[model samples]
Structures are given as structure tokens and as C-alpha cells.
Target: MEETKDVRLALYETIMNLVDAGIHAIDEEGRTMIYNQKMRDIERMDSREVLHKKLEDVFRFRSSEESTLLKALKTGEESHLVKQTYFNNKGREITSVNHTYPFYYKEKLMGAVEIAEDITKIERLIRRNHEPHTGYTFHHIIGKSKAVSEVIEFAKRAARTSSYVLIIGETGTGKELFAQSIHYESERSRGPFITQNCAALPDNLIESILFGTKKGAFTGAVDRAGLFEQADGGTLLLDEINALNIHLQAKLLRVLQEKKVKRIGGTQEKPVDVRVIATMNETPYEAIANHRLRKDLYYRLGVVTLLIPPLRDRLEDLPLLTRHFIQKYNTLFQMNVRGITPEVLTFFHSYRWPGNIRELEHIIEAAMNVMLDEDMIELRHLPMQYRQSGHYTPAAEKSPLLKDRLFEYEKQCILEALEANGSNISKAAEQLGLSRQSLQYRMKRLGI
Candidate 1:
């Protein structure tokens, strides 16, 4: 029985030390019971300095209440993603986001445990600088299909206004690109532009990060501007806006309606001239129905909503998009790759591109890496998963008629010419070395 108990303790310690985040635990009397290696690295303290020592002796806080672990122990409550900054025994300052919980046995308090993720570097960088320039513009968007072209035109119009905009699309649909284009096009172009993923941080920390924090807002919080204040006089792109809990959404709506922000635990409201552009991966109506998004906030933000079409919905642009990615990889790889084979293009069109344009670009890049002296991307060059996914048709299984091949070739040529000419029938006809009427006839026969 003694040997089994020893082995269990060893296993628990091993697992605790292996965790990426710092793990620290203290008994009801506040003496340290567990201090894992990660905690040692985070606090720059040796185990000898921490283990069995009173929590107050190992770290200095403004008050006993400022220590989350101690607070949990005292209150018998759990706290998550609480930002805390303190000084270790070596007098070195450390900052971390922590989740602390109290443990009990037989209705009697035992101890408190804390898991801390070090964010000192991130906090310092954010304080030193606003986000880097948003390098994308409307010109960077590549597509010629009617669906994409219409959306781009609408986005250009939205770019001219300062009204809040909601962009809805699936993942990898370039919602940020549209958001940046609007910011650069508006009069606020010279001002700051900030982005925050709504789902990136926990509920407790996200509120402070978005609305700024006052010194006395919570334990260890310093007076700091949030993303909204940082983006004053410019734009704030909130990605995955639906990820925000409904309470925060209500706060956000209040901010939008009043054009002012109140810092956490602060009474004075600061007027901010910031335009918000929010994006969501799901439909707003569905999100509202499911209570993931507040209806009032949706109506407030959807003043000029833009729904970006998925890749599968606009497959007509596949060839043009593929060629663009080919040129991009060519410059990147310093190779003279031309284009993809018809069989590969057909396979790409048939497959449902769940990852959208990003997936297409990645596939092209992967195919180019595996190419060996082949100028064109063929079926053999595609990723193994794609080829074996049961969506690809082997050459032997496809129709092998010479007439059918000619028909597809001719149709593709006309489609490319029309795309190049912006669907101008006369220009496309001239480019195709045919009369306007003949091109129209072919288009009709080809069901284009």
C-alpha cells in the first residue's frame, strides 16, 4: 500500500510538470503544496524557493485580495482567465492569465490550484505598438465571376461610408480583406486600424481587452486602452463576432448606439470615433435564432452587410483563381510552372471546397512543391488525401470520347476569353477570332 501511494504521487507530479502552463497549488493555510517546473520558469524561481513556503512570502501582491489563488481559497469560488501581475521572491515582475479553482473534501476546504499562461511579452508588445499595417486592399482580391464581381462592387460602396458593417462568410472567405478595403477607402484611412478575434480570449479577459481596464477594475489590472480606444478615429475589425457572449454583445451595442465607451470599473464615458466592422462564419439569422448573437446588435451592425460567396458557389472563377495562385507560387518557388491540367481542374470543381479559396491556394502550393520538371499541375501532383478522397475520377473512369474532349477544350477557351474581356461579347468574339454572333451561338450550345 505504501509503494502504490508513492507511485501515484510520482505520476501526479510528472503529469503536472508536463503541462505547458504554470501550475501552482497552495493548502488552506496558504503554504505551497505544488509548484511545477513551468511555474518555476514563468516566475524565475527555483522549487526550493516556492515549495512548502507561504504564498505571501513567495510573491508580493498589492493586497492579499489581489492574489487569485488566495482569493479562491478564501471565497471557495473558481475564477478563469484572470489577468494578474505580481513580483516574485527575486523582485522580478511577472504577468500571467490565470484560472484558479478551490478544492474541498467532505465539505471542508483543502487548497487552491492555479494554471497560469504567461502573457508578459504580449502585453509589452501591445503597449509598445498598435497592430502592423493592414497590407490588403480591394485590388488584392482576385476573382472575375459575376457573383464575386457583384460583391466587390457592393463592398466598394460600403467602403465609402463610416457606418458599421457586418460581413458574413465561411472560414477562409477573406472577410478581413473586405474589412480592410473599407477602412482604407473611408476618410479614416490615415487613422489606426485594430483587429481582435472575439473567440481568442476568455469571457473575463475579453471584456477587459475590448473595453479597456481601469486600475481598480479587477485584481492586478492597470489603466489601459482596449482595442476600441486603440482604434479611435479609425476602424476595429472584430472577427467571429458571434463568439462574444450575449452580455458582452449588449455592452457592445450600447457602445455603438452611444458612440462612447466606458472602461471597466470606470464611470466616465469616453467618446470614440471608431467604426466597427464585424465578421461571422455563420448566417446572422441562424445565429440569432440559436441565441449565439443578440438580435438588437445584429440589426445595429448589419447596416451594410456583405455576404461573400463560397468557393463552390463561384466555381466559374476557379480557372482564373488557379492561374493567379500559380503565378504567386511561381514567383515564390522561382519556378516557371504554367497551369493545371483539365483533369485536375475538373476534380477541383467537383470537390466541395469547405476551406474555400485558402484551401485552393494551399493545394496549388503543395502541388507545386511535389512537381518534378512538369510544367503543368496534373492529377498525380495533387495531395495524396485529395486523390484518395473518393472525389477524384481516374482517367480510365472518365469519358474518353475525342469529340467530348474537343467540346470541353473549346468551351474552356471561350469561358477564359469572356472572363478576360469582362464578359463583353464583342471583345470576347474578337479575342476568340470569331464573329460576335458565332461566339453567342457557341455559348448558347455550351450552356454557358
Candidate 2:
């Protein structure tokens, strides 16, 4: 009878191995009793290496208290199609959907069996077809200063090439916006353009997401093309590339050199036609010194490097940018706001915008929201931080006499009244308890 039972168990294992999906069954003690070839391939493990090992010993679960197989066995509950993302023993990340069910014989509980399907391929396909398109062009970039114009010209030249490009700039200096413009203006604009932020994902996952993965390469892994393949024949923007670790940087350099990628568990390399554009928010040397970015990879990607000028360095373009944003917000908010006050412009010029153009746009949009029927943006609508800086004040040059200060204050009140009254001299004068002629005379004398 025991020999017959052993033969039956071997037959069951053979049948399970023939199935197309990953199948793993553990005894009541969580020891691997039946792990098929497909499971070995899905996990990129040798069947002989893991056949008799305990589940926890093979794959380190976060905690024994939350083990999925353990829970299913103990509670006699079935876990159906639970999607999970985790790292295997070798530190390769795997994303898969699993179904864990309790095994039983007649009325006697046996163990737990799990069936898993890797979804990495499905996700890549979805991203390829569903990613949003970038609609910006060179004309959308607003700048006229020599410093900015030079950067724009260089970017246009870089866009025409198929070589790798790198953009260096401070945060909020529009690095990604410039990248999008490059893609839209390039010859490959008709093809798909995909973007991936290197710093946004963890190191183990970023590599698989970039270079693709092969079946049996890691636990719960399936064959799938990564971002490189997804962006084939198009542009691939790797934002914050310095965030990738050194080990991964070496791997990336290989891909760039060969123009081919071998999936994490794949043995054969696949050729890909992709134009890469990398962006760095910090100085490249700093990243190298900190050991975040590899020097060789930097040389490869910096073939067409473009550095964007910060707002402070190109103050000459502030007026043009201000008008651009004002018109932008006017149409967006459906308001006919004319322009900003001269006092506000003075403040904008004198103040150091640490956040660059992004900060300026925020300030303008916030001020526009509070216009209250006034056609022009005023000093009071400005943020308190800007107002407290005293940069916009005429008193910055020299303190005025008491009479002169009073005259200036009176002039400001008259100007505000006129603006609030829709530039009606009679209404403004009435609000100020004066005749229209008196208000006009004050305006002329004070240069309001």
C-alpha cells in the first residue's frame, strides 16, 4: 500500500509539471512537497535546489504572522487572485497575481497549494498603449534672453540627433518640460515617447522595469519587455538618472553601449532602437562625487548635454515670462485681467525667486484668483513673503521726507481707487471724497 501511494504522488507531481502555470504545494508544516518545473521556471530556481526547502527559508516573508500560505492553511480559506509585488531571495523584484487554496483529503485538511501568474508583461503592454502623449513644442518654451536662447538652440540641435542627450538644471527650471519639447520636435515624434523617473522606483525594480525580465528569472516573474523595448523607435526620458545605484549604473552603461537588453533572467539579448534623454536636477559632478552616478555612464549620456539657466540668471526675460503667464491665467480663469501693477513688477525683479519660473507662475495664479473685478493685479494681492521683503518699496534707495512719503501714499490710494472703480475718474474721486478735477490734479502731480 505504501509503494502504491508513493507511485501516486510521483504521478501527481509529473501531471503538475505538465501544466502551463506556476504550481507550488506545501505540506501542513510549510515544507515544499510538490514544486513543478513551471514553478521552477517562474522563480528562476532549480527544482533540485528548492524541492524540499521550507517556504520561509526559500523566500523570506516580511513576517511569519502574515504568511499567505500559512494563513490559508490555518484558516481553511482560499485567497483568490491576490496581486503582490515583492523581492525574491536574490533581490530581483517580481509582480504577480496568486491564488492560494487549502488542500484537503475527504474531511481531513492536508496543506496549501498556490498558483501564480506573472503580470509584468501585461503592465508593459498597458503602459505602451495608454501612456499620455506630450503636446509641448519649441514654441511653447517662453524665453528671449541670450542665456535662454542659447539653451533653446542647443536643445533643438540635440533633438535632431539620435544620440543620447542629458539636461542639467535646478529643480523647477523646467527640465522635464524641455525634455517633452525635445521629444515633440524630434524626427521620432510620430513614434511613442515614454518617460520613467529613475528615483521614483526602488533599485531592484528599476532595472527590471528598464531592461525587461525573462521567465524563470526570479520568483513570480514572467517574460516581459521593459521601458527600453516599450520606447523602441521613440524617445525614452530617464529623469533623475543619478538616483540609480552604482551596480545598476554599470548594467545601464552596457545597454547603452550595445543598444541591446537581456532580461533579468533571460539568456539572449534583444536589440532595441531607442533615443535616450536623461535629466539631472543636481550638478553631474556632485552626483559623481557622492557615488550615485557612474562617471562612464555620464560621459555616454552627456554626448549632447544642455544646461538650463535659472530664473535669477536670466532676469531680463522676467517681463516676457510674466506677460505670458498673465495671459495664460486670464484665459484659464476666464477673466479679462489686464496686467500686474508696476509695484508688483518691481518686487518680482528685486526678489530672488528660489523656486524659479514655477514659483513665479504659482504667485501669478494665486494673485489672479483674488482679482475681485480689478483688471490689474495689485500689491495687496501679492504673497506676504514678497510684500515683507521690502524689495519692491521705493524707500529701499533712500528714506523719503515725511511730506514726500505722505504724497506717495496718497498717490497710491488714488490709483487703487481708480482701478477698483474701473478707471472712472468721477467714481474714484467720489470714493475719495474729492472732485474728479482734484483727483486728476493729484494724479498728474504725483505721477500715479
Q: Per-candidate TM vs. native? A: 0.66, 0.63
Q: List the residue pairs that clash in candidate 1.
A: none
Look at candidate 1 and tell me the lDDT of residue 116. Answer: 94
**Local accuracy of candidate 1 as per-residue lDDT tens digits, 80-159:** 87889899987887889898999898999999999998887658646544857745778888888888888899999988
Question: Could you report the Cα RMSD, in angstroms, for every candidate shown?
Answer: 14.5, 22.3
lDDT of 2 at 351: 70
Name the weakest run of 10 consecutive residues (lDDT summed) in model 2: 393-402
Q: Which residue pairs in candidate 2 collide?
A: 41-216, 44-216
The whole-model lDDT of each prediction reads 0.85, 0.80
Worst ten-residue run, lDDT, model 1? Answer: 393-402
User: What's model 1's lDDT at 329?
Assistant: 91
